[model samples]
Target: MTADLQLWPIGNCQVSALLNAAGSIVWSCVPRVDGDPAFCALLDTAEDGNPPRGIWSAELVDQVEVRSRYLRNTPVLSTVLTDARGGSVEMLSFCPRFERSGRMYRPVAYGRIIRPLAGSPRLRMRLAPTKNWGDPDVARTNGTNHARYLCDAHTLRLSTDAPVGHILEERAFRVERAHHFFLGPDEPFVGNIGREVSRMCDLTIDYWRYWVRSLATPFEWQDAVIRAAITLKLCQHEETGAIVAALTTSIPEAPHSERNWDYRYCWIRDAYYTVQALNRLGALDVLEKYLSYLRNIVDEMQEGAIQPLFAVSGESELPEAEAEKLPGYRGMGPVRIGNAAALQTQHDVYGQIILPTIQSFCDQRLFRMSERADFERLESVGELAWKMHDQPDAGLWEFRTRSAVHTYSAVMSWAACDRLAKAAAMVGLADRAKFWSDRAEKVRETIEAEAWHAESGRFGASFGRDDVDASLLQLVDMRFLSPDDPRFIATFEAIEERLRRGEHMLRYDSEDDFGLPETAFNICTFWLIEALFLVGRKEEARTLFEQMLARRTESGLLSEDMDFETGELWGNFPQTYSLVGIINCAGLLSVPWSQMR
Candidate 1:
């Protein structure tokens, strides 16, 4: 088999991946983020299973060399290819930067091709825009410099800002020296093409650099930290402040397996650490935007009271569907959309959302009137926490097999109640403050009595299951246990003995529950770093932190999981929550608590 590289492009509006040369994979759901993938070649291998054909196609061509990179801190991606004829082509991808309002969603993909300085590259390029995940009959309109493809409610217009030759009917094209080709929906070709390209590139670079400069920590691994921060920010939905779990969907946990899932929604547990990282870096503008987005959606969540995840636009209805038109990545099966976990009762969400919001307010001093409304909402969340304190649910992992009374969820629930009490008192909601405080104490007492295992000397994964969970590391980060407490230290040691995979940590011991080959959880390992520091194991924490830094990819990116045996990255790439964990762990390890403010 040929060594094929697949680049799946998935974002708020686009679901596609470009392979080297012409082969590509694209998936899109109609109307909303949670809709099923229409182009799911990244999930299934059978020809009949693929959709939105021609969006990704391959043609015979001479030898070509390619190199790609993001333009310094910006989401703008640039790829350069050189053919055997000594001609070179540069491809650029970016979404337009603009402020949005109202309810409708407008997402456009902008791509431009440029010839090299020496001469025009004799190149054969094919364009296939799919509709309904490879469903046919895409209407095409020819223009002076570009072609427009429209299907259903989606419109993809390919226009060049520069003058170039066009060979209609055939998607292949050849360009002259010093010429540029621009393609996107609603792009004007009459304007100054050269100037527009230069300006967009410069603006995108400047935006990323400015945002990255906001970091306050000068840790030893500064480069890694900043890159991770940039990746996390890219996962953020700038319009609504919601941070997605990952950019891609339906990348199966195991090849040809039915475990593929959609991860493009905002997860409350993930967002808690995400906001904390941003807050620590002094990037509260985006953090506050996300908090407001959450505030807007909290009341709108109806089915399960409060879902674990939601669409970036705050839609609660995320129905699962399959895109049978596109072959899966590496032959994984059943590319899916709309996570069913949304309906699962994850009690930790209440605490996960509130404690982080409270921490952000305290750290950044962003207690504006709008934030006060968010605090009021926190009181209601506290009410939910009190009501569900004794109830059993699907726990933090969102296990598909069964529901259990997870101790970590209970711990966070108690923390939420505690943070709400603090926020209520601070904001002059005294009556409500007392109510939360009383409930918080009661819940804390309950957890200490029921959640702890005396013989094991560690918190269990759940009250029913005596297995230890990596999430219990939160006991230190949440300050639920005194760092020096013998029990916390014992728990840490127990986790190290049982769950540690070399230097990293696993989420738990249960193999059948998560439905994938067991691996070290990147976020949990980072949490362990904080646990070590809190327990006065500073040298040990620093050593472990350094080892964790070594785990990052050459580009300084971290994935969701790492193979315990081979130490290779598995699961989603550029996971926002994992990077947030790295940033937070680095901060706690390097800076003293008293000096943080």
Candidate 2:
């Protein structure tokens, strides 16, 4: 089967893998999210008479049907393969993660347990992993009860109870009993593999369940909210507290559109929204961890414009390049690696940084509250926001060849100063509170004077322009203008008229670097839903939100973009920005918890 957006993701925060319908680990990055793809068959399109390599599959002999789903409230995936003769096998896949030694034990490993469900099912295991962006298959070495594959700088060892010859030679074997496989760092088995894998599965399930139970879900759509929340958490690299935009990269926004770009690293703007959505559900753990990432970025930037994106490790330099070896998704070609967006100047990041950090000072529930020292460091970011709130830069959309004084960047800059004022008051600093408040007022005045389009009686996307993009809908959400304000109301109406295409919302109507966008951006559509509900268009908002929910993959997750006409989801898989929209809209549109009684 060809690679598609309908893939399942299983991860333990450190590393993740995307599995296809046949329960094959088709795409995964070892070491870290930004590392090389160890199993990159998702982008493999060999034309050299070679069958596609870099996939791990347990081929059920004469398989006739397949079905898969996530274990409730957990990231563990279970797939059942039914053969033509009515025999079936259940494959359970997950990454080992739980509380161990009084701390979190999230390993960079994958665990699979297979058992016969019906008659004696025969299985042929295909465990081929590639290295250096699908350029060549990894050299393998085998020992008793284990096989090791050399993955460039590191070795990936698979410790399994199945016969080594069957796996090495791709021979069919009978599944008379249960089998366990642990693929992780090169290491010898320390304990009984069967007992350990089983224990890890139970512990992992318990960990996810207990985590979900702590969430304060809305009265409706609890299941969808839980799933989106879990997927968002999966996108985070907990070790560094950076949340990636998506799991897979180079999945085109539209077929053969060359819109594909690597999304494995963190975009400051995207991470802010991720933490904000999770924070609304009272999942402060993510916010707390992410605050550390922001703190490091703030410190490192002592004085400079913060880039739009960064490596999860907090390294600033991310040079873009393409992996010519692996053909693109569906053989589109030109699969990209590192993102070039890191080189762009996106002034809105200052607000994104302070937006989440302000919560640290205000929310007393957090274990580590922001102190005066933290506020002092944040003032540096605020100073930059104040300095460049109205300057021309690559707006939040990250326009490639053009730069404009985007309304969104100005409003976010205003928000940075505005929130700092509130945080100062929370920390009992009167002088600094007044200082930030004055700066915020100045930035607000600038936006009102420049972004407001008097002729159209609505705010435009950028200063002194007639374009109305979906981002203008965020004015109310950012609190730059009240929902009842006539300007915000007019802006929302104008944006809907221009960007709304059927049930989907385009980021903009005008042509971009790749010409006019053909598919609707998922996050922008969610923004519209929120705007619709906020403007008292309750029924219409609910209907549109339902349409988006229906478009989700069978796993109840969304990608970055979707074709409005075909309803085909495109772009990166399990996009955090898209998932954040799910959680935010569900929280807004659901019935109040107080009325549930």
Candidate 3:
């Protein structure tokens, strides 16, 4: 069987991998998440079982049974494969993420520990580290305990404790001893290989445990909350403070949908929700890093221009291109790399950029509170919001073929002005507060008048259209309308009738670039859950929330989309949007800690 995304993620925030159920390392990128996939077999069906080119698998010959799980509240993964004769081999995989000498020692690397579990299991180590999206094999030369693979200007070294001849020849051998392997940059191994890896493993485990301990998660759904939080943390590029939408490139949204897009970049809307979710868990590290990225963008766009997405390094131009070498997930072709949406004017970003900055102004708990300069800079963004609140742009759904004056975009604009008004008041600038407040109220008036489809008694998706969008569910979350408000209920009912598909929620059922959506947008489903809760359908909300949780992978993770009919996961792995849903719903549904005691 090929690799399924019932996978585990191990990373130090610099690099990550998705190990599938077959005990094979499937999808992993190098240098950074947006960089080339060194092991790209997750999408290359031509090399499914041919491990001569891209994979790292410890195959157990005559294998009949296999099982995998994370090592107890940690990101470290352990998998066991048993052969027909009850012989078994266990593999433990993790990328060491720990503090060393007053610095985080998270490298662009991975480490694995393999040993016999029962009956002297036979093993064939297929550590084929390829390059050019699995199209070329790197030239390798072995030493006594290490092998260096040279690919262009890059050199990767794999240090192992197993027999070098067995690894190079792809020969199976009966396990006589435990082995350790570390595949990383061309660097010398410090001290004994086995002892060093063991220590690193211990330190990594402790580090993750401590990080998990620090989370201010809700009382219930603790496992789900922790896993989601950790996954979101992995999505963060700590060096530049950019949070990616997902770790993968072109996993199609639906079968043959041709809607596949690269999601590894930092989207303003996606990042905002990610930081907001992490912020709720007291993960300010991600927020603080992302704020740095935002500050740079703000300086670059002194006139308040912003893109929908950017490279994690804050590069603005992410031109979309297809990789013909790799087949898409399940042979869905047109495997894409960069995203063109970076150039499209996604106006909702103006507010998303400001929303997090507003936190720095209001939160007294932060060590570095916002100064007058910060608020003044934010005012420029609010001015842009005021000017462009009703302008036509690529809406949040990012329709490639069309642009419109999206209601969600306008409401987000109103939110920016509304929040800035309060920030101004907090700083005792009554005049500025009134200025922003007036702008906010005017924006609100425009939304109420234009976005409302009066004959239908509902809020429409765009100014002139009578469509109900699932994004409307976010109106309550954004506090644009209170649950007690009649307009919200009517609009929500309209969405329920139009977008809800049994237990799933589609972003919209309308035909787009690839016809009608064949799956539910996972985050939108969570929004529906929140809307249900706010509308006093608390029981129904909890039921739906549980149903959504049931769809998560064996690793307690989710992809970007889910099949409405079969409930199968689709799109990219470890989606920040879906992870945010888990955190938001858990926080909303969990019984109060005060009452729990």
Candidate 4:
């Protein structure tokens, strides 16, 4: 079994790290989220004769219990580990990232402060960061107050107010006063170490609190929604405005399922849902920044062609390969790095790309107003959607073994044309508006004719396949069909009967590359919840939504896959897709401010 880690994440957009419940720092990618995991023990389990490597742990001797929590509304995690003898140490951990000199100074670093809380607690500091996935040995050169770790191409320097020898030795020592440890790029730390960290901590805390205050959230699940929002915001690569799929890689969808895959790169479909849900809460900064990323990706596309996903830096070629690294999550082998799905033609990307840009034209809150040129550039994407709406390709599921014209992709293509029709009218282009409107009607009619399984009284997964997929719930959610439409209601009923396994929803019951799925995809369940809410099943939707929220880790975050029978969270962590569900459902179910007043 894998080490059951209830991870708490601390990040400043440029970088992020995860800390397990026992205060073991694991699963942080250096330089960027998609970079090599400097600390990767989250994916490794301790085996006999060999201790788990690539983890930073500060253990209090004879520790009996540990408690961890985020400070109020911030990502700053304050963990306290206590011994049976009543001695305890409090740890304040974060990646220092706030506005400095009117610029975001989010470095590839971590700041940790350890303090003696109770009696004298002996602490051991093990800072064994790894490089190149499997390689964990780094040569250390020590100075008076800092240790320069020269390994591979990267040089990491650790500066501490405490004795450098004590930390380098990984030996036990008594905690006297507050001790500060700063690990980042090799550079000389200026001024007093304690004072600098203290100031950064206070400012970071203030930055998070102030950022949360701007969110317009539901009264009942406000805390839950805010946590999800903060995590989603942290997933974005602030430098390039690109948001990653998740923070880690190689966490399998099910135990020994061989379904492990990396999720650090940005997918247009996932990022679309993420920014859209946050936009519901009046969080336009994410939308604004992502649009810039979108512009760059589109401008670089050859003949307006789009991929399912891309590297955060907009690199198009991501050749999927296995990392021969420190045993996988629980020693489940075949750790993967880059994703091959990037090379697939998922036609739904047209709508995913266009959906966020639609806001740019209409939302006056944005600084870069959409112009005729912007709409024309988007028309190129719309053309692809129109041409390929009925043609066969790898659908949204990214199936490797086979290809078909998925109903969901066709509907998304329809949405592209449909929205463009409205947007064109908004900009007073009557001729262009009617042109796209006619195309939208054609796509809709084709879907109604080809996708409907009349004998089953529901839509199938693809044109010829008589299989059910929970993603069809998006038909109503995406506005392809009205919530009260009989066709949608029938499809919803069909999905629940076939795909809903207790409180969870399966992406599909059919077998593909892997055998039948062992665990439910979390976002499919969220889509189910949203579908329920739209169909006037408010009570059922809220109850199921609550049950899903209960499945979140201790830190109130979720991974990509969940087991309905076992309640085990798998797949990549702090999944942007799952968090989008939290925000979307909270916004739907919460009583409006007008009603509250």
Most accurate candidate by lDDT:
2
List model 2 lDDT by residue over 1-597, tens digit each: 123777999999998999987889999988888898888988986677875778889879999999999999999999999999999999999998999899898877999999999987899999988888885658999998999999995689999999988999999999999999999989897799999999999999999999999999999999899999999999999998999999988999988899989999999999999999999999998998999999998888946788888899998888889997878898986799888889998899999999999988878899999999999989999999999999999887888999999999999999999999999998899999999999999999999999989999989899999888888888888999899999888888888888899999999989889998989999999999999899899999999999999998888999999998988989999999899999999999999988978
lDDT for residue 402 in candidate 3, whole number 0-100: 89
For model 4, the run of ten residues with the poorest summed lDDT:
1-10
User: How do the predictions measure up, each by TM-score?
Assistant: 0.86, 0.98, 0.97, 0.98
Residues forming the 10-long window of minimal summed lDDT in candidate 1: 1-10
Model 4, 130-162: lDDT tens digits are 788857787889899999876564678998998
How many clashes in each structure? 25, 0, 1, 0
In model 3, which runs have C-alpha deviations exceeding 4 angstroms? 1-3, 47-52, 302-304
Q: The CA-based lDDT of model 2 is what? A: 0.91
TM-score of 4: 0.98
Q: What is the per-residue lDDT of model 1 for residues 89-126, given as tens digits with 9 covering 90 to 100?
A: 66665544432365322244444435553344655554
lDDT winner between candidates 1 and 2: 2
**Better-scoring candidate (TM-score), 2 or 4:** 2
Please list the C-alpha lDDT of all candidates, in the order they appear.
0.65, 0.91, 0.87, 0.88
Candidate order by lDDT, decreasing, is 2, 4, 3, 1
Query: Which residue pairs of candidate 2 clash?
Result: none
Query: What TM value does model 2 have?
Result: 0.98
Model 1 ranges with Cα > 4 A deviation: 1-61, 98-107, 117-120, 161-182, 186-190, 301-304, 359-367, 370-374, 513-516, 536-555, 590-597
Error of 2 at 491 (Å): 0.9
